[model samples]
Target: MLRLFAALPLPPEISRPLRKLQKDLVGARWRPEENFHVTLCFFGELRHTQARDLDELLGEIEAPAPTLSLEGAGWFGRREPTAVWARVRESDELRGLASACERAARRLSIPLERRPFTPHVTLAYCHATLLEDARAWTERHQAYSSEPWQAGAFHLYSSQKRDGGPSRYIAEADYPLSGFTAPEGMY
Candidate 1:
């Protein structure tokens, strides 16, 4: 079985600043810089044939690339505070791309969670983080925002789990957007 998802990788200008926010929090397992991405759709573990089908479906999706930016920080799991994240500013283009990913899964008869899409880049997983500490950390970084950049492409990524480390994500296939030309000093 292969663990898979479709996501947009971040450029250095956005990711490098996010790297600086990984400190001053206890019980937080920080995600590596390489793992920083905005997931469009997560298709859990699937048989090889199913995975291949999904990949082919993903490649056929055609849309203009979305311009995205990180704004502020937040956490999930209100009671226990299970994770920390940097919020992505919402855009219709982004949502349309995400919806397209879902439609692909539906066509393949793949079961998926019907959660409302909340665009964000997960920064860390909380093991035993205190609620107060989590709130404070988010408060401190609430005003953060990165320069917006247009995504050139999205990818079908395969994730590999490690025994005592963060899971490694590999981009198995690249799907270029319909109309994307990087502007000066952006990509």
Candidate 2:
């Protein structure tokens, strides 16, 4: 089985700033710069057949690359924060791409979260039961913003444990967006 997800990579223009947001907060597992990505959909632990089907189905989606800007910070849990991340500015393009990915996952019978799309690049995972004043932590980084970057492609990524260490995410395939002009010096 493979843990799979669809995501848009952050270009250096955006990631450079996001990397600096990592902190040594108590019980927090800060994500490395290489791990920063805006997840479109996560379909965890798929059988080999399911993985191939997903790969083939995702290839059918062709849309313009989403334009994105990173800003602010927030956590996911109500009483206890699970993860903290940089916020993504809302755009119809981003929404449309995400919706398409979600639809593909559903068509494959992959269960997915029903939560409304709240796009963010996670910075860290709080390992404790709760982090003191998670709100204050987010507030401190509220003014954060990264240089705007246009995604050239979306990727199918595999999340796996490495040498019994932290989970590592590696791209299995990259799907270029239709009619989406990649910026100069961009991947």
Q: Highest TM-score, which number? A: 1
Mark the regions of model 2 whose C-alpha exceeds 4 Å error after superposition. Answer: 129-132
Report the lDDT tens digits of candidate 2 across residue range 1-187: 9999999988767877777777746667888888999999988899999989998989999788777898899988887788899999989889898999988989989999778899999888887735565677788899998777778889999998888556899999999986677666556
lDDT value, residue 168 of candidate 1: 98
| Local distance difference test scores for all models | 0.93, 0.86
Residue 91 CA displacement from its true place in model 1, Å? 0.4
Prediction 1 global C-alpha lDDT: 0.93
lDDT of 2: 0.86
Clashes of each: 0, 0
Q: Which candidate achieves the best lDDT against the true structure?
A: 1
If scored against the real structure, what TM-score would every candidate get? 0.96, 0.93
